[model samples]
Target: MSRFTDFFVRNKKKLLIGIGGFASVIMIGFVVFLLNRERILKYAVAKAIQKVENKYPAKLKIGNARFLDLNTVLVTDIALLPNDRPKLMQIDTVEATVSFRSLFLGRMVFKQFDMAQGAITAFKQDSVDNFSFLYKKQAAGETVDSTAKKTSNYGTLLNRLIETAFENVPDGVNFRNLAVLFKNDGRTINMNLPTMLVEDGEINARMTITTEALTNTMYVKGVIDPDNYLLAAKFYGDNQSKSIEVPYIQQKFGATMRFDTLSLSITNKVYKNNQLTISGESSAYGLVLNHPKIADENVTVQNGAMKYVLTLGDHYYALEPESEVRINKAIFYPEATYETRPKRKIGIKINSPDIPANDLFASLPPGLFDTFQGVQATGTFKYRMNFFVDMAQVDSLKFDSDLDASPDFNITQFGPVDLRKLNQEFTHTVYEKDKVVRTFQVGPSNPNFTPYNQIPNHLKYAILTAEDPRFLTHKGFHEGAFRHSLITNIKENSFVRGGSTVSMQLVKNAFLTRKKTITRKVEEALIVWIIENLRLTNKERMFEVYLNIIEWGPNVYGIREAARFYFSKEPSQLTLEESLFLASIVPKPKQYRTYFDAYGGLRAYPRYFFKLISGNMLKRGLISPSQAASVSTYVNLSGRAGSFIIPKPDTTHVQLMDTLQLAPIDLLDF
Candidate 1:
């Protein structure tokens, strides 16, 4: 027992030494693990940086990078594009804490991560011609439209620049958060995303992308900084990837924009095709209108009004006003209101009562009124109405005259007139015969506007038969007839005929009439092409137009005067038979003539010749059967010398809009 104790004492020291050595070895292993951790983290960081450089902007700037734990690191910085410019996306600092525990075992793992203080800013600039919806805008001194001097030359150069800005960013893309795990020997990398925010007071949202190019899964979250407007975003890939300013592409443009309150929160996925499905609303105020025509001189008072809604990328905002407007009255015009909502059922009544009224039925025809009469009427009259004549629901009709007068005629002798059909016509019809001229009247003559319920069915059908038959099937211009006309004109080398529909005719008459040459025809075709894109309905207005202005006659050039001179009645009263009789002389008057008794008294001959014009057009289905029937009613349709008169609207109602901005006009859409 004594010897055992002595040996124990000496062996105790040896045992202690052995114990220390074992502990030292263990400590050394731990130190080695911690020392190489940053290296592993750096390697991972380098790999992630490479991805951003390859996929997005190449100029990634981080403020600093540091170790967060024994096996994890954190990095923060401001990001830039390859061109090195401060832009839409600017991050003060982004913290990416990465772990490297698995690196010692020949693997990578990110254990923890965080990002703070980032934002995205969107701006509308005062100078718009400098901007392009297709790409980021250039700074001052760069002419966006180099062809402003020669608009024909600038598109190519601008396109090249736009291409370069978006070349690296594939159109369809999505990203999500990453996940990683680590063990005793190896570690796992994860790209897990944190929450994110968008700009312009938008709802906050989450973004996830599934893409083959990104190995199919990426998680992304971000929030925009209210103060600086930088998007603080976090991304997670298959591996916990550490990237500096991964969202720098949007920041390349300096914060030239001042946002009111840009907020956003949303979640959506990107597919293999790289399409981002973002479902959220982003609203902004005072978005600059980028129209080139927005000059002070061009905005004062205009011949016509224009409205536009501009769209920037997927983002949209209110387009600014084009004309300086003033509000004077709250009166509503039926034509204007109906134009606003045609399909809806809404009716209003006339409000003002001060408008003086009269019935000009007797004075409406052409031969009866002087040229000065129409002008005197337009200048002196002002109209106020509750509902539009074209939009109102009509139940019955009453005809009365000033100072009490009646026409000495019977229903059977005169024939029934298609009142509803007459209202549908857009033409300015004047009836005139020698010293008797009259224009068609549209209303009850109360001086207030009223709307029409339905175009007279008979007139509608008749005009359809006589005018544009393929109106329903064709887009705007009849293709078959147009092609035929073009070929014939080309072969003949003279401008003779056309198959342009009533819509096309309206386009030619109202929107444009620059030159009277084939080139004008080419421009017309181009305009028609654009109009087709609008898809207009209710096209009957075009067929009703009366185009007899520059005529070769004696004080007679309008439908109202011509009708009154020959038929001794208003155009609205022109029977189907009388209509056919008048329609015959339109193409060329002198070619067709009626019976002329040498004794000067009216006489019926055994064989009389009348131009069968309306008949031919009806047989060809150019007009509706109802119109043909109306033409058949005129017992003695005359084709002889008559009083000349121009057709004009008997009653005119013009509504003054309170403000131009009530509808989107003035700003051009992107």
Candidate 2:
């Protein structure tokens, strides 16, 4: 018994050591499994992506992927391109997690998709964007059964994976340090999102944007269900000292603009059925506008406020369209509406009661009112306007407006600055190709400022139709035209088109330089407003000035000069086709100069341009269909007296007086 006990005690140590060795080996195996886990996960993900690509029309690539936890992966340098694009998104890092239950069920059910340091660039091709792919399309030549087959296997698995990742309502989706860029043509809009979070269909984002006019930060919180077309959100933005400073504004616009404060806020609440209620408020204070050429001049807005509420349904928003805007307590109501049904129609209205003009213009900086330095101004300025447009026949738009001042204001400075004298013969400063400003006068007493009756009806009609159909109607601005220009510019991603009014052009030609500066544009607009509102000159006078002073060709100024240069005819002798041809080259006279062959004959393209002008003239009722049909596309610039003459009534002997009801003559005629 004693010997057996000693043997057992001695062997007990060896037995315990053996058991410990086995445990250590098992522990080593487990460590090896953990070490290779990332590789296994990567392979699995790659395989799944391959399966997805086999059925769907997308490309997926991964630079490197590693397991963060048992069910989480940290993917680096991932790129997902779709629709045969180069790369739709380039993600620096993405941390994705799968639910334990989903992993166990052999499904890629994602619980989270947190992305960081990424850039998403979108391209707009023919108005179809990357997001447009979400709307499923039926495959061509596919029967119902075939279509069903298309979604089976890999497609079904991939769709299930996607549904599980998104429709399951993830706990959180975080996007950090992301930039979204949209490019159409030469224009680029960038938005930097510092932090964005999506939780239970709710989105919270804070972004910064820099544009030509302003740099601002926006905060947004919203709930959007694209599937149901439901959206609710709150937005807030502010631009104070951080706005584009005066120096930057001057650099960009060639004018200086300053605003003490600008703030905007909006709220949107939408019901489940897509009925949306929107409310917004905007305010700006201490606005200042200045142009270098207009010495000591300042246009100021001490304060401005706007508030509105709109309710939108499936068809239209802002049905009631109750809104108010006040600039220094000068209230105005501006509304536009759209109706869909039997015939689509749009209506716009702007109205305001008589407001004290001095109250608004008085805020200008000292010496800013030097133009009216010796003028005694008194009386309220009453404004009202109405416009209707048929969407189908946009050319047949109707507009009516009245801007009147009660009890005329006297201005003596206007006489010495007679705009008509300048129009007749003024300093024409040409920005030469060599970057030199060359100046010259039209003549000692140019006859180009022809009387209204001497101006050919066809020429008048052409200018009105091509340059500004609403020239005689609008006060100084055409909101609809400007909107169209802005939209087209944005869509094309470049400012290749313009919607400048004839009055604006005149102001630019007479008072401002053609430097393509934003400041110049602002100055032009301001002067046009003053001339129109203060009744500095009548519409006919403005039109006459514009026709006489505007550039027509290389060193050529005025319709009379253009007529002599192109056709060797007086302005009154221009035929309908010649008038249309002249209007077509107004915007690009220098470029179109080459359109004439070495023999001084118009090219085919120029003839085509004339035809285009004819189309617009016909639509605007400036030229009858018969007149348009009679117009010839060819233009012979041989400069022979009767080479290209097409006889028309010569109304030059008629009274050189306007028959259309003229607004009361200027209070102080120049």
Candidate 3:
């Protein structure tokens, strides 16, 4: 031990000298590196540009690049040109102050950034687009290393994206004269930003957007915190009279959406245990939407807001139950989940907890609920709905919706149409293409109106069997039928079937316009539910009204007129065969002529419908086996309907017989 200690003492001085020499060498090398740091950074930038050009179908050009200081860079005349297309992006000057420490770690972390006279043009003509190369897949046989690709869950991916986006946002920015142009086919939309500045996490911007319809100026102000993933922004028109119109949607999707002011705030984002949660709030004022599929007229919401908590997992994205939506003065909580794995499923639930009836009524968007616009109500109401669907098992899809009002709830004033009017005699108008085609009384006042008891049992049953077999037993809706309709529609990928019940049909015909739109359908459902649940009118009265107002043939209204026009008889004298024939044509009243051959014989399609309806009726005991078997698909046209049929050869008998024999008994038509 003593000898080792003596040896160490003798070599300690030499060891110290050697260590000091190594430290000096390292310090000198680091100083030299710091001296040439600008050149090294420029070389790295050039290499990055070369790599980008080689990988993509575009070329990156930097006219000049230099370092203003150790941590600042200035680039001039930068352009990105795609092959055989217009330039994708051009910039006059770009200056950035990067974090020197981050650069040493091979990361470009900008502390400040400034860009001026920059423009991006995204053009598409025919099948060619200028910017698609950015998203294009790698070339064939140019394999990417699987090990290099990170295995990430949905939450991880989303978190990474959010972090990257927020982290890249510089603390200070000054962007001027920036424009983005989108041109497709013959349409062009240009967005010009005159000045956008960010200082100390506060943002202010002015943008002028030009489209085919109008030019609008928008102002944006926001506060951002990159470290905390927080952002609050407000976007509004330059003036009260002007609204910011969302461009491209009108030209691309046939929808026009405009708003006076919109405010958005992202309060928090968290990722943990393979789940990502984001909380945010958004509000809009004076929002207007016009779309043919939504409504015939513009739908306007004066004020709307929502506070949302969104969660994303491996196979699902969800709006958590903590989310709340407010329209005007009414508030509702909504939850929705969309899952892609195990099975593609969607679930949505909404709960409005005992809101004032007036608030509920007032919250309805204009034009969407025109009938309820001026209606005044009192008391409180609550509504809840749960809808779930698994794409693989649509037959088992669940849709449960309920709306309840307090016992004292009452409508104080009527709107355009009163719900109680159907209980008494009232004029029912039939519209074709939004034009009044026929007007008839739905009561004893009309000579051709048929009372429920006076209508033939065969005709009533036939219509019920063909249209809504459980109309008498069910409430306003038949969940089984709706499920079946959903299954069939999903299978066919077309809206070829509707699950409307007798009550729904009555409400649609009596209280709603004939325009086939989403708004009309929702209104019809709501009205039916109200009438059925409130017992505003009896089932018999509704059925009577429905039978009296339904269109049968060309200019023909009601069962009485239909019987007289088709068979020269009254509604009570119509036979089962005649009833089925009339019932089959109810869905296609305007195309009734097409159901019969030139010889006035029922076509194969109509025969198939007759067999299907009769078979279902027999299965349900509405008709006996003998009646089902003996029901003929033939109808003698002796009234004015005869004049519309042109006599010709009958050739569908063989096909009709085969279809009747082979088709399934459970098949349905709507």
**Candidate 1 residue-wise lDDT, 1-670, digit = tens:** 9999999897998988999999999899878767766666566566655544444433455555557655335566655444332343445544443334444444334333344544433233333321232243444334334344432222243334434432322212222232221111121222223443333422233433322223223344454333322233333333432211222122333211221222233222112222122222233221111111221111111011112221111111112222111111111122122222232222223222122212221122121111112321111112332322222222111111111112221111111221123233333333233233323333334211122222233333333333445655555655445444444444445755555665565455443332343434544553443344333323443343322221213444544555555666545565654554444344344422322233222222201112233444456665566765454322443433532222332221111121111111101110
Which pairs of residues collide in model 3? none
TM per model? 0.29, 0.42, 0.81
- Cα lDDT for residue 584, candidate 2: 67
Model 2 TM-score (2 dp): 0.42
Highest-lDDT candidate: 3
Instruction: Show where candidate 3 strays beyond 4 Å.
Output: 1-75, 79-87, 95-109, 123-161, 184-187, 269-279, 309-322, 337-346, 594-634, 647-670
Where's the lowest-lDDT run of ten residues in candidate 1?
661-670
Error of 3 at 61 (Å): 4.9
How many residue pairs clash (N, CA or C atoms closer than 3 angstroms) in each of the candidate models, in the order given? 132, 2, 0
lDDT of each: 0.35, 0.63, 0.83
lDDT of 3 by residue, 523-577 (tens): 8887787678678898888889888888888888888889889889988888878
What lDDT tens digits, residue by residue, belong to model 2 across residues 620-653? 6777999888887667674642243343333322
